[model samples]
Each structure stands twice: as C-alpha cells, then as structure tokens.
Target: MTIPLKLHVGGMDCAACATKIENAMKRLPGVTDISVSYGQELLSVTLDEDRTSRAVIEGKIRALGYTPAGSDVARTPANDAQAATAPWWRSPRGRLVIGTAALLAVAYIVSHIEPSWATWAYVAATAIGLVPIGRRAIVAALSGTPFSIEMLMSVAALGAVAIGQAPEAALVIFLFSVGELLEGLASGRARAGIRALMDLVPRTARRLRGSEVETVPVEALQIGDVVLVRPGDRVPSDGDVIDGTSGVDEAPVTGESVAVLKEPGSTVYAGSIGIDGELQVKISRTTADNTIARIIHAVEEAQATKAPVARFIETFSQWYTPAAMAISLLVIVGPPLLFGADWFTWIYRGLAVLLIACPCALVISTPAAVASGLANGARRGLLMKGGAALETLSKVKTVAFDKTGTLTRGKPQITDIVCLAGDENDMLAMAAAVERGSSHPLGLAIVAEAERRGLDIPRAFGGSSVTPGKAVTARLKAGFVSVGSPRHAAGKSALTPDQADRVAALEQAGKTVVVVLQGAQALGMIALRDEPRPDARAGLEKLRSLGVRSVMLTGDNARTATSIGSLLGLDVRAELLPDAKLAAIAAYRAKGPIAMIGDGINDAPALAAASVGIAMGGGTDVALETADVALMKERIEGVAALISLSRATMSNIWQNIALALGLKAIFLVTTLVGSTPLWMAILADTGATVLVTANALRLLRYGNRRSD
Candidate 1:
C-alpha cells in the first residue's frame, strides 16, 4: 500500500536548497513522488509503506542536512510554537555566524600589533565556519546531491584558504551566513501573513445549551450547536445566525470595506468581527474546516505547485550550476599551465567565479513572487488553486459571465401583476399551488409573492409536468392551469390583440412575463425582472479599461438579455442551453483565452472548457469546489480586481528575475577581468539574493486600494 507523508522542514533558506533535498530523497528505495517547497517550508512525499517507512524516508532527508519536523503521527501545535518562537541567536546557524564574526573581529584587532599571530587567528575563524559547512556538503554529496549551494560555498572558501587569503575566506563564510539569515527573515514576512489569518479564530467559543451558556474550546463545538457572540468579538466559526441583527466587519476575511448588516438567516464566516447586537450563531463548520483555516492551507499548498516560469528556472539551474563549475576548473588550469602565469593569482580568480555561481537568487526568483501573489489574493478573498491558475488568469483576454446570480441580483420579485379575468388573489393562489414544488427561479418568485400576501394555496393539482424551457402545466379538478413564459402561453392559448399587445410591452420593457392560464383561457400576466447588481456596470467598465471584452450568456430571451446587457455594456448571447453554453465557451476560445464566471451547477461544463473557470457565489459549497478560481464574496468588480492582481504578480516576477541575473552577469564580467576580489564576489551574490526576496514581497499590498 502507498502512504503519503507531510512534514514541515527547517533550514531551507533558498529555492536551491529545496532542490537538493528533493534530489537526495528521490533516490530512496520506494519514494514515488516528492515535492519540497522552500517558500512554504513543506516536504510532501508518497511511497510504498511495504518497502519504506516514515523513518527511512525521514532519515534520507536528515542525511541531506535538512531537518524534518515530526510527522502527523507525532506532530503537535506546541512543537510548531517552539520552533517559531525560538530566538535566532539560539539556533546552531546563528551561533556559528556569531562565533565566526567574533573571531574575525579579534583577528583584525590583533593584526595591527603582530601580523604572524593574525595569520593563524584568521585561519581559526575560517576553520570554525568551514567545519559545519564542509560536513553538510559531504553529507549532501553522499545523499546523491553534490551540486548544492552549500557545496559551492564550501569549495570556494577552501580554495581561498589554499592561496593564503585566510582573511578573504573568513569574510566569505561570514557574508554567506548573513545572506542566509536575511533570506529566513524575508520568508517569514510571507508566512506571517498566513499566520495572521489563522490567529483570527478565537481559541474558545461561547456555546449556548438551552438556558445555560458555556465557554469551551473552539474544537469542542460541533455542528448544529449555537454560540453567542457579544459586541466586538470575532466569530468563533462559520455559521448562520439564529437571532439578533448586527453590523459585522468582514474586511479581514472577505475584504468588504464597509461593515455588513447581518440579520437572522444571514451567513457569517469564521474570522469576521461582530459589533452592536449579540448574535446567536449556529455552527455549520468544524474548527479544522473553517474559512480561515482552508485559506491558509490552500495558500501554503499552492507554493508547491510551481508556475511555468518557476519550473523553467529550476530546470535551467540544473545544468547551469555544473557548467559554471566546469568553466571555473578551466580558468584555474588553462592560465597557469599554458602561459606560466602566476599560479596564485589565477587560482584566486577561479574561486571567485565559483562563489558567483551560487544560484540562490536565480532559483528563488519565480516561486517567491508566486507565493506572495497567492497569499495576497487570499487575504482579499480571491482563492486561486495554484500558480498555474494565477499564471493562466493573467492571459485572459475575454471574460464570459453567467446571467442569473452572476451579473444580477439572483433574487427576482414580482414587479407588476395584471388581472384580465377573476380576482388577483384567486388567480395567484392557483399559480402558487402549481409552482410550490418546482425549483425554477421564476416559479419560486411567483410563489414567494403569493405567500407574502397571506394567500392560502391548496394542493388541488396532480400529474404536474414541465415543457422543457417553456411553461409548467398541471391537471386540476376544474381544469388545467399553467404559469409559464409568454411563448408557452401563445402556443396553447389564443390571446386577443389588446391583451397580446400588453404582453409585448412587458417583454420589451425587460420584464420576464409569465402568463397565468386557466384551461387555455388567459387569466393575467405576472411580470418578473432580475435587476442588475449595483456594481455590475462598473465591473464591466473596469474590464473594458483592462482590454478584456465582456459578454453575457443566458437562457432568457434576446429582448431581456439585450435590456440587461445594454444596462451593463455587455454583448448578449441569449437562449443558450447547457450544451449551447459549452459551445459558446469553445467559440470564444478561438478569439483568445477566456475565463467563464458562474454560480450555478449548469455552468460547470462551460467553466471547465474555458482557459480559467471562476466560480462566483457567496462562497457556497458548489462555488468553493467548482473551478480553478473561487470568488467567496459576490462582487462583480472582483473579477476585474483579480485580473489586475494577476498582471501585477507576473510583473513582480519578471523584475525579480532581472535583478537576480543582472547582478550575476555584472559580477561575472568583473571576476573574469581580475578587477574584483574573492570576498566581493560573495557579497554581490548575497546582495542579489536579498534584493530578489524583498521585491517579491511587494505583491502582498496589492488590491488594498483603488490606485494600486
């Protein structure tokens, strides 16, 4: 049987370090799949349990000088807290740097008095730093990864010592260690954003049981239990309110700027804060499955799924490292042997080139930007599945939207009622009795209006059936009654010129007129219209400004589609079935990549067919699990905001790559000309790695303001 293992890894300061661990672990006997992400500090592996156990796999990782935090079988929150809260000076890496730096300081002070004593003093400092680095390099080589950044630093420092440049060797090790410290600090900022989300849920909740209210751990609360939230308290978990109306601030979870007025039956997420009224919220989700927890998990897991540019960089670095080493070997041998040039001078240059080829910044450039982009998007409620989705979304040229619930307010109320025959109440009761069982949006709208008027609808019909996209008819005691579209009414019943003209006027006015017929004689017409959302027009305008075309596809008539389309400045594609929508997605693909946004089950096929599928709802289960992108909050403007975010993330990644390679290229030229010293090469490499990391962090502030 195959079993999977997930462990939090430590000591991975660069993307090249992750590659070294992955290469060493894949050679284990039964390891089938392995992924190590330095940005996430995660090691995920799958293997056959019969051939290899968790201990054997973890031993391989340990042999590569990477620490694997205990597996799920023995892991605890305290273990993580201990590792995270521990001071930097207490760790082995920190002590080595401090000791090496202290020795280098003592040697510099002593060199002014006696140069002979300072020579060995610098050797002692270099030896102290080189011992641990050399041991790790040997262990990495034995584990099948001989070309790691550690191996490069170890060889470069040792070569500098051989040429009697002990001072330069000591300073090189100190600077390399300092660079690793800077990387750890920068990566922590990205992880801290995710930790802030996890901290939003209160550890304990106030659960209400009958007349008594008990305060217990959040994990102790189960589904169906009600909890009381007082003023200025964050919600314990995801649930629906049973009583009390409050102004809830959801900016932390959903990024809605203003406070939302949440009443009874309104859905509340786990991290939102409650103000004013005390709300009794019934728990609907478990502690581990809450909204904030899922977002954190998704963002961490997304780091392991590399984007195309990241994968390309990783592949390029594989050959780039060894090729640089080969060139360094040639430089040391060709100059001294052929021309009898000074051996010490050429060998020093060779070591400088090797240190310049560390590949730390080049390897980490893409993943750091991608991880920051994913974390930034989650903070604003745009949950992208992986880097692939984020990259693909940046290339979307057209956005296809579903009509109902997507571009408009999903709820449709009865706007106008016309009575052609009997009392409006009696006709409404007949229509409500026929439509109470059906789940169509129009039918539900009619039934809701009848119930609001306090009409008693009796179950006086049987053998009810729907005519596909047309009306619904049923067999009653007196005769058959139907409440369907005007087209369905025109086919079965004849209407006089005046009544027909009234229906035409309503249809032209963008009202979905459902004719109520009693035994083939028209009783009246009830006009229903699903109004456009308040932000719908502005969202399309934003998309237009970004050079993305907007179009709406619906099963409604062309007149209605055009009315709503004109209001929102969108092209209308109406009367499309589920299969027709799928075809429409394919047809749009001919022009350019498209993203299909929808909230209903029928939109799934079209979503899958598009370049990127964006599920739009109030974070319902169907929406969360439907597509590559899930919009938890129903903001039509969010679609444009996400597109802007994707473009910004890609731009950040390009800037990182240029900084990494551009610095390396400049130092490579100087090292070849003998103008740069050995220690300066290492300093340039360290500076480039730190600069790359800091640039990628800029994406975390994206979408926070309109100007951004």
Candidate 2:
C-alpha cells in the first residue's frame, strides 16, 4: 500500500534546494514519489511504509542541510523568524553575518599594523565563516547532491586559500555570508506575503447572548449563532446580515476596492470589514470553511504542482550545473598545463567562474512568478489549483460555458404565469407542494415563488419521482401533479394553439418555460428567467480581444439558449445532455485547449472533460471539488482576468530567465578572460536571486486592481 506523508519543511530558500532534496529522496528505498514546495515550505511524499518510514525521510532531509520539522540543524533561518518583527541583525543567520564582518574587520586592521601577520590574520578570518559552509557542502555531497550552491561556494573559497590567496579568500567568505543573508531576507519577505492571509481573520468575536453581546474567540462561534459586527470591525466568519446596514469593505478577501453595501439578508464573507453602521450577522460556516482559510489551503497545495515550463527548466539545470563544474575545472588546469600559462592567475579566474555556477537564480525563476500569481488570484477571488492550471488557462483557445449558470446567474426566479383551466394561485400551490423538499434549482424557485405569493400548499400524497434532468411529479388529493419542462408536458397530449403560442413566445424571450400539468390536462405554464450576469458581455468581449473564442453549451432548449447566447455574441450548442456536453468538450479539444465553466452537478462531467474546468460560483460543492479553477464571486470578468494574469505571469517568468542567464552569461565571459573580480561574480549571483524575487513580487499589484 502507498502511504502519504505531509510535513512542514524549514530553511529552504529557493527551488534549487527543493530540487536537491527531491533528487536525494527519490534514491531512497520504497520512495514512490516526493515533492518539496519551496513557496509553501511543505513536503508531501508518497511511499511504501513496509520498506521505509517517516523517520528515514526526515533524516534524509536533515542530512541535506534543510531543517525538517522534527530535526534541528546548526542554524535555520526559519527558526530565526520567531522574532519576525525584530531587526535583521538579531536573527541567528543575521548574527553569523554580523560576527563574520567583525572578524574580517579585525583581520584587516591587524594586517595593516604588521605586514608579517597579514597572511595568518586573513586565514583566521576565512576559517571562521568557511567552517559552516564546508560542513553543509560535505553533508550535501554524501546525500547524493554533490553540486549544490553551497558546494560551489565552499570549493571556491578553499581553493583560493590553498593557492596562498588568504586575503582574497577571507573577502570571498565574507561576501558569501552577506549574500546568503540577503537571500534569506528576500525569500522570507515573499513567504510572509503568502502567510499574511491567515492573519486577516481576527481571533475573537462578539457573540450575542440574549440582549447582550459577549466577547468570544472566533472558534467558539457556532452555526446559526448571531454575532455583532461593530463599526470598523471585520466579520468573524461567513454569515448573513440579519440586522442594521453598513458599507462593508471586502477588499481584504475579494480584491474589490469599493465597499459593498450590506443590508438585511445579505451574505457577508469572513475578514470583510464593516465600515459604518453596526450589524448582527448569523454565522453560516466555521472558520476553516471560510474564504481566507480555503484560499490559503489552495495556494499551499498549488505550490506542489509545477508548470510544464518549470519542469523543463529544472531538468535543464540538473545537467547545466555539472557541465559548469567541468568547465570551471578546465579553466583551472587546462591553460596552465598546455600553454604554460600563469597558474595563479588562471586559478583566480577559475574561482570566479565557480561562483557563477550556483544555480539559485535560474532555479527560482518560474516558481517565484507562480507564487505571486497565485497570491494575486486569491485576493481577486480566483482560485486556481496549481501552477499547471495557471499555465494551461493562458493557452485556452475557446471557453465553453454552461448556459444556466456560467454566463447567467445560477439563481432562477418566477417570471410569467399562464392560466389554462384553473386559477394561477391554485395551480402554483400544487406545483409547490410537490417541489417542497426538492434541492433542484428550478424546483426551489417554484417553492420560493409560491411562498412569496401567500399561497396555501397542501401535502404531497405519496413518494415523489424525479426525472434526472427534467422535473418532479407526485400525487395530490385531487389527482396527479407534474411540473417540468414544456417538452415533458407536450409528450403526454397536444397543446391548444393559443397555449402553445404563449409558451413559444416565452421560450423565445430566453425564459425557461415549464408546464404545470394534472395527469394529461395542461393547467398552465410558468416561465423562469435567469438573466445574464452583469459582466457577461464585457467579459466575453475581453476574451475575444485576447484572441480566444467563446461558446455556450447547455441543456436548455434551442430558442432559449440561442437568445441568451446572442446577448453575449457567443456560439450556441443547445439541448445537450450531460453525455453530449462531455462529447462537445472532447470535440472542442480538437481545435485547441478548451476551458469549461459551469456551476451545477450535471456540469461535472464536462468540467472534468475539458482541458481546464472553471467553477462559476463558490457555493457549489461539486464544482468546487471537481473544477481546476473556482471563482468565489459571480463576476464573469474574473475568467478573463485570470487568463490575463496567467499570460502576465508567463511573461514575467521569461523575463526572470533572461535576467538570470543574461547576467551569468556576461560574467562567465569576463571570468574566463581574467578580467572579472571574484567579489563581483559572487555579488552578481546574489543580486540575481534578489532581483528575480523582486520582479515576481510585482504581480502582487494584481490583487489591488479596482475592478476585473
């Protein structure tokens, strides 16, 4: 049996560290799969427990110079963040950098005082910092990772000292330590941005007790309990407003800059601030089920899945590192042996080339941009499953939409009532009784309409039968009642020309017309319309501007579907069953990668069939579980926004790659010619890492866009 293991990993600064650990762990017995997420600091492994155990895996991670949850290493930057608000010099890694600087300063002053003691002084300074780097390099080598950045740094510094360049070696070690400190600071900043989501929900709440409000922890707030939201306080949980009115700022959870007005019966999300008037809200979900918690979970899980471009770069780097090491070695020995060149000068250039060989900048290029993109999407109420989904969405050539919900609002309302034989109220009451407990959207709409009109609904006589995608039927005291699609009623008997004309007019008007029938006699028809979402037209236009096509695939009748699709200028494929929807998706795949957007149980098959599945609303559990991407808000614009964001992320990744390689390529040329200084080489490598991370951070602004 395969067992899954999940653990928090510490001290991994970039994707290179993750790749190193993955390579070493994959060589272990019974290790079926291993994934290390650098952005999330999480390790997920699948293995056969009979052959190997958690203890062995964790031990291997520790051996690779990373701090696993249970294993304590000599120094961990993750441990250093316990006083996260403190100055950088106070952390353990910070202290090392400070201490090393002090030693280098002391050695420099003494060397100036006595020329004879210069060599020994610099050697002493180099030894202080080299001890830790050398230990890490040796540990990494034994664990099957022989060419890590630490190994390159250690080898370069040691080789310099062996050539009687103690002063230059000391300077190299000092610069390397400072470079490491900068990397930690930058990586820590990015990680903190992701973790800040958890802090949005406050710890405590004000639960109402009779006439009084009592302070309590948010965890103690139960479903159906009303909590008071004072002005300027964030709502403690997902709930509905039951009292008062206020302009609530939802920017914290959903990136809208404007405040949303909250009134009675309005649904409010957790972590949104109530700006003006105080309101009492009834809790709907526990904290873990709220928007903030779910978004955090999604981002963390996404880090485990790499994009195709990322995979290619990682593979390229695996060979690139060893090839670089060979070239560095040739620079040191080849020229000196063949052309009788100056050995000392060639060796100095070789050390500079070694610094350029560290793959930190190249390794981090894609994941960094992806991490920022995920964060941006989360803030905008877009939840993509992973890097792969984010990348695939950008390639989508056509977006197929489920008409009832994706483009139109999923909520259907009663529009028109036609009377044939009985009074409208009496006929509606019969349909409502049969649909009283049905969870279907159409049935619920009927029940809600009947209740709103103050009709008296009698009890259903016996067990009710449902036609999967059609309607419901049950026996009433007078006779049998059936409320379903117009086609379902038409099959039983012929409709009068006048009645048929009315139904045709309603259906042509883009309304869903259902026949209310008693046995074979048609009593009347009810027309329900689900209007197109406010952003439907604009969003589709934006998609077209990006060179993507739009299509509507629905189970709705041809007239209704075409009418609705024409509103947004979309291609219509109407009257599709669930199987047909899946077939349509497979056919669309032949044109190019397609995305299916939906919000219902039947849409699941099509969602799974498409290259990318986007769930339209946050409320549907089936869509949430099955779709590759989910929009927490009903804003259709988010679909286009996410695709635009994905394209921007890919563009950002290419820029990072060019920068990482471009800088290294220039340094490599200069190093071979003995022109580039050793310090400048190490400085460029560290600078590249920080610069790539900083560039990725630019995507954070996407979260703050005023509107989609």
Candidate 3:
C-alpha cells in the first residue's frame, strides 16, 4: 500500500538543510520514511496508499517553506514558475493568506464580539486561505490517494467550519505554514559552506603567448602553455614558474595566513593569489586536473556519497511513509466503525491522526546530524570530504603514515660535516663550490652552510650536471669536482680507509652522508637527515591510546625507516615502494578499516586507494587532491586530532539519530492510542527537530576535547 515519491526540493544548501527537510517530511503521519540530499536538491519519500495523498505531502513541504517539484500534486509548472519568479514562501501570496487567516483567528479568540459573527468571519478567512493552500490536498484525497497530511489538515479545518469552530481551522493551517517556513530557511543556510569553496575557482585564464596575453576559458589551457598572472590575481592553472618571481598568498590552498615567496623553479597551485609580482608560468596540468578542479570534484563526490546511516534512512523512508498512512487510517476508522460512533466524526479524527502521523521528523533526523558534523569538522582544520569519509574515519582501527614529510620535518638540513684527509675549511670550500651549481635540496643545504660560514664560492665552476640518486659533477678551476652520494663517489674509489670509516659512522646514525672528492682522495662527508617533528612522539602516543594501531611506511631504506619507527614507537615499519605501500594498506584494510597519511606524488595512488587518506596542507597537488581529509597545519598532532575528531563527530551523529527516532516512536505510539493531542503532535515534530540540531552541533568541540 506504500507508494514511492521523489521530489525536487528547493532551499536546501547544506547537509543540515537536508536534515531539516528529511525531519519535516518524516513527521507527517502518512510518510513512512524520507531522504533529502542538499547536493542533489532531491527528496525521496515513501507513503501509505490508504492513509496519505500526494497533495498532503506537497502541502507539508509547502508548510515547511519548500516547494516540492514533480510530486503527484501536479504543481510542477506552478512550482517551476514560483522558483523562477519569487521565493517559495513569498510566491503565490501563501504567507499573506496564512497571515490574514491567523489575524482573524487571534481576534476571534480574544474578543467579546458577537459569537455568530465571529464564527462566520473566521470561516470566511479559513476558506480564503484553504482555497489556495489546501486545494491540492482536498483534490488528492478525493482522487483515491486518501489520508495525506494535507487532506487531514483540510478535513479538520472543514470539520471546524462545519461545527462552526472556524478560528481553530485557521490557527492550525497558519501554524503549519510557520513551521514549514522555518525549516526551509534553516536548510538553505546549512549548505552555504560547501558552495563557498566552489566559488573560489575562476572560470577563465589568461594565456601569455609571444608577449601577447589573451584571455581564454580555463578548460582550453593546455599543458606547456604559458599563463600570465598579475599581482592580486588568482592562478587559473597549476604550473611551474617560467619567468618572473613574486610572493603568492596561498592561504586558499594551504589554509596558512602567510604569503610564500615564489622564485623561478617554484611550483604554484590554481586559485592561489599572487601578492606582489607578475608570473609567467608553464601549465603543468589541464584544467580538469588542476588543484582547485580536483578539490571541487572530490567535494562533489563526497557530498553525493551517503553515510551508512544515511543509506539506512533512505531505505527506511522508501517504505515507512505509505505504511504509516495505512496504519493511521486503520487506527482511526476501524475502532469507530466497530463501536458505532458517528462516521463523519470518526473520519475527521482519523484525518487528524493522519496529519499528525506525517514522517517529517524521522526523515530529517540523520541528515541534519551529518551536516552539523561535517560543518563542525571544517571549523576545526580537518576537511572531511563527505559523510562516507567521516564514517570511515570513525571506524578506522589502523592508521598508516608516510615517514619523510608526515612524521619528520620534510626539509632536512646539514647537521654535521666530517673532514677526512683535508682540513675542514678546504673540504667544505671544494664541496660548496661543486654544490653551488646544483639545485638539489642537499646541494642547496651545502651552499647555505658554506654561505653561513662566510666562505666565498668561486664562480669559475661552470654549470653542474646532476645524476638522479647519484652525484653532481662540476668543472672547477681547481679540477673536476663531484659532490654526491657515497655509492657514486665510492665507485671511483675516491675515499681513503680512514675517511670511509668516518662516513660509515655518520651513515649509521641515520644521516644521509654526501662525500665530496676530487677524483682520487676523499674530501669530507656532509650529513643530512630530516629531524623528527616536535609533536611526532606525542601524536603517535595519542593514536596508540585511542586504540588505533600506528604503522610507518616510507620509501627510505630499512635502516632509516627502522630508526624512525623505533624513535616514534610505531607498531610496524614498512620500508616500501609506492606499490608496496598501497598493497600494505589494502592488506590492512582486509582486517578492518585503515587510514593512510602521506604527502607526496608517489603517495597519491595509495592515498586514493585507502579507506581514508589524510594529506598535509603543503603536500603535492596529487596528494592533496587524493586525500579524504587535509591537515591544514603540517603537524603530526593534527593527524591524531583529526582521527579523534572523526570518531567524536560520528558519535555525535549516531546520538542525534537515536534521540530523534526515539522521540518520534514515543510520539507515534501515544498519538495512535489517543493519549496525545493534535497540539502534542505539533510540539513533538518541532521540538525533536530542535533537539536533533542541538545534538549534532556537539561535534564543534571535537578537537578541543583533551580525552577524546
């Protein structure tokens, strides 16, 4: 006897808004269940054939301040016109009509005017309001759909009219409309946060070709094309700097407040604003693959994916609506027929039961809880892409982390330089001269060290050539110089026994020792290794306490990985390739839910394939785009906080759902047995909504909770 109904609902803008609509629909007597998605602007409801008509469902939505499009009420064109012409509540003068009816009811209730005249006036005002608002409900009930919430309200109003109690009818309709309007307004505001993120990407870009800058659509900019960005302009594409240098304000991308200096060879992201310089950048990614574009895609996907509990509500609403309507009809009509009460009065009461039985409350309970949870997460530095990710995070039993940038400070510096046969000054001078022409991070560190020591590097060394994972060889006035890894220099037998021993000692300490030699003899060994981030140990301990097992995965060799793992007290150490890391995550996922934290291009695949992937804010575009959650502040403590927050948010959502449904069940039982009045129905519907909303808001304190 249950019929499925899909409605396109307007005025929903966030998860919270979707919750409000779902709740409002569930509260209706005939509605069995409901699902509302703010991202899709869609609402699906199930209703009982014997108890509710489509008109009642539509009317309930209208009362809550939403226009239901494509429902059986057949107001599609009118709804579309209303959407185009004015706000849902303001259009068709529904609010004004309800207001006039309300004023007349209030005057009659308080005045000493002639009772007969007051009754007639109230009836006339009710008729005026019902003609526009309740007409659909009346028609739907007559059309074999019977017992909709709207029909119930209409029948009650007409009964009041028939019995000469016009003021009551007007009051009921006016109050219903007020509730609808409040729900609509609340839903609209909740969706605004996600919409704001979408607004950051510009639709166009300016391409600089042969000194001519021409504006083109963002999608048309191909890789290798040069794009010109002016000061105060947002980068329309992700690219490498080809010309010019400037400070870029990357707050939108990294969530940091400071502007980062950008010189030649620096990388820039889409949607980041240029603060002080013009830039000519060679596009590295297509518009579809750009940072902002991927962010939008991820957020959209997240919003569309329902949480597990949300899916249950969707399935529940599919049947709950129609079943509730039939039960309400049986409750109202069967008892009276057996007892031989007046048929009309019994039918009227049955209709009241139907109106009160609408499933508005049940439909919204879960979604509102989700919206509030997501918003609260965003407010704290954790950006949960969707309900699914939020749900996954809560259930994660194992957390895997990438070592280099995630656990240790990504930028390692030269901590020590050991001289072998030569004096310290000579060894450093030659090494710095060779490294000065190289661009590797280690080379940069050596150059910095030499500069710090006030050693002048001769300019006579021609440009250097670098071999990946090997060494940088340069032509210097003294001779051909090489500064590189120990393996590369060792192949040439450049180190003496004493110098090799010294380098071995440095390497054993988990430092990357670079040996500098001019062909035959060892010069000196310079060690570089990322220091552990200050919060690394504390964060790891927190995760352990939370019962989430922690593992460290790194591309670094076993020695380095083992050293870091031991220092941080990780339960497992995985020194792996990108594929090995991904396999490890998949294997872990087989046992239960797992979360992976990484921040490199190599980590992108694993990050995407994990149950939950968290990326550092300053990580590569691929990693950031692939991650489900982003830690805006690159700190290990934030990772622990994110996990804790996710668990807390999920708990809050479940609690809200339980409370909302529990209240509804109690109300339904009481109403069915005649222990509750029509006024009680109104209070339960509205009051439960308020309570669910308040409960969901508790997620706002997720991160700040010390024990959590």
lDDT of 3 by residue, 1-708 (tens): 888887877655344345546666665677876777675477777888678877877776665445666654422223433454456556434475457656666557644566546766777777776764576564444443343445556665676577655666666666655555555545544444444444455667889878788999877999999988899888887899978999998777655557888878999987789988999889999876776556554554565678888788756754665776677678667877788766655554554555555555555666665665665555444566788888888888988888877888877788788877667877787788877756677878888888989987865355787787888878778787788888887788887676678788877778889988777667778898787888899988888888889988787888777767787888555557777877888999999988888873557787887898887765355444557887755667766677777677667766766776677678777765657655455555556666565565555444454544
Q: Against the correct fold, how does model 2 do in TM-score?
A: 0.81
For model 2, what is the C-alpha lDDT against the true structure?
Answer: 0.82
Q: How would the candidate models be sorted by TM-score, starting from the highest? A: 1, 2, 3
State model 1's lDDT: 0.84
lDDT of 2 by residue, 300-401 (tens): 788668999999988899899899899999999999999999999999888889898888888888888888888878767788889999999888999999
- Give the distance in Å from residue 441's predicted Cα in candidate 1 to where it truly belongs: 4.1
> Which residue ranges in model 1 land beyond 4 Å of their true spot?
1-3, 30-32, 46-63, 73-83, 337-340, 414-502, 514-526
At residue 455, give the lDDT of candidate 2. Answer: 94
Worst 10 residues of 1 by lDDT: 72-81
Per lDDT, what order, best first? 1, 2, 3
Instruction: Give every collision pair in model 2.
Output: none
Q: What is the lDDT of candidate 3?
A: 0.69
